[model samples]
Target: MELQRLRDVFRTALDLPADAPVDDLHYQDHEKWDSLAHMSLIAALEDEFDVMIDTEDVINMSSFGEATRILGKYGVDFNG
Candidate 1:
């Protein structure tokens, strides 16, 4: 459920297809994910998860896998 929610956030922020593979997407992996879109994606994730991400982590949030790991630090239970 949380993963799906993150995918939704990606779709909204990155302008991807509703059925696009968001979990494996990385920053620059898709043409739509420029720096502007990266910040937009970050904002969407922050808003959706209600978690404040540090600037360093924002830089490190380059992939969905890494993102889930980072979000885990904020108490987002990916297992749920």
Candidate 2:
């Protein structure tokens, strides 16, 4: 459930197809993932999950898969 919501965040931010594979989506893979999009993504995620991510985690969240892990640190349980 949470992962799907996370996917929705990615989908909306990147303008990606709903069926787009998340795991393979990375920093260099999409042209839309520029600095502006990165900040938008961070804002969307923070608003969605109600968590404040610091700079390091924001920098480290370079991919969709990594997003799951970083969000885990904030107690957003995708597995549940």
Candidate 3:
């Protein structure tokens, strides 16, 4: 559901493999998750989830798990 969609967005934005484990990924830690990729990831997330992310939240989104928590603030439910 929403979690899978978020994973898909991460995969597409970061150009990751379909089976890549995103839960533990951190910005600038992953080879592909650079600054440019971070912006792409943010845009993809906003588009996919239909929410406008704040600048502070964008800066705070340093990890995949953190992204999930931030999205939760925007009404995205990870728990079914």
Clash counts for all predictions: 0, 0, 0
Please give the range of 10 consecutive residues that has the lowest summed lDDT in model 3.
16-25
Worst 10 residues of 1 by lDDT: 20-29
For model 3, what is the alpha-carbon lDDT of residue 6? 93
* TM-score per candidate: 0.96, 0.92, 0.97
Question: Local error of candidate 1 at 25, Å?
Answer: 0.6
Candidate 2 worst ten-residue window by lDDT: 20-29
The residue-by-residue lDDT of candidate 3 on 1-80, one tens digit each, is 99999999999999999999998999999899999999999999999999999999999999999999999999999998
The Cα local distance difference test for each model comes to 0.92, 0.90, 0.96
Angstrom error of the Cα, residue 60, model 2: value is: 0.5
Residue 28 CA displacement from its true place in model 3, Å: 0.5
Cα deviation at 64, candidate 3, in Å, is 0.5
lDDT, candidate 1, 1-80, per-residue tens: 99889889989999988999887888898999999999999999999999999999999999989999999999998898
Which sections of candidate 2 miss by over 4 Å? Answer: none
- Report the error of model 2 at residue 79, Å: 1.0
The candidate, 1 or 3, that scores higher on TM-score is: 3
lDDT of 2: 0.90
Q: Select the stronger candidate by lDDT from 1 and 2.
A: 1
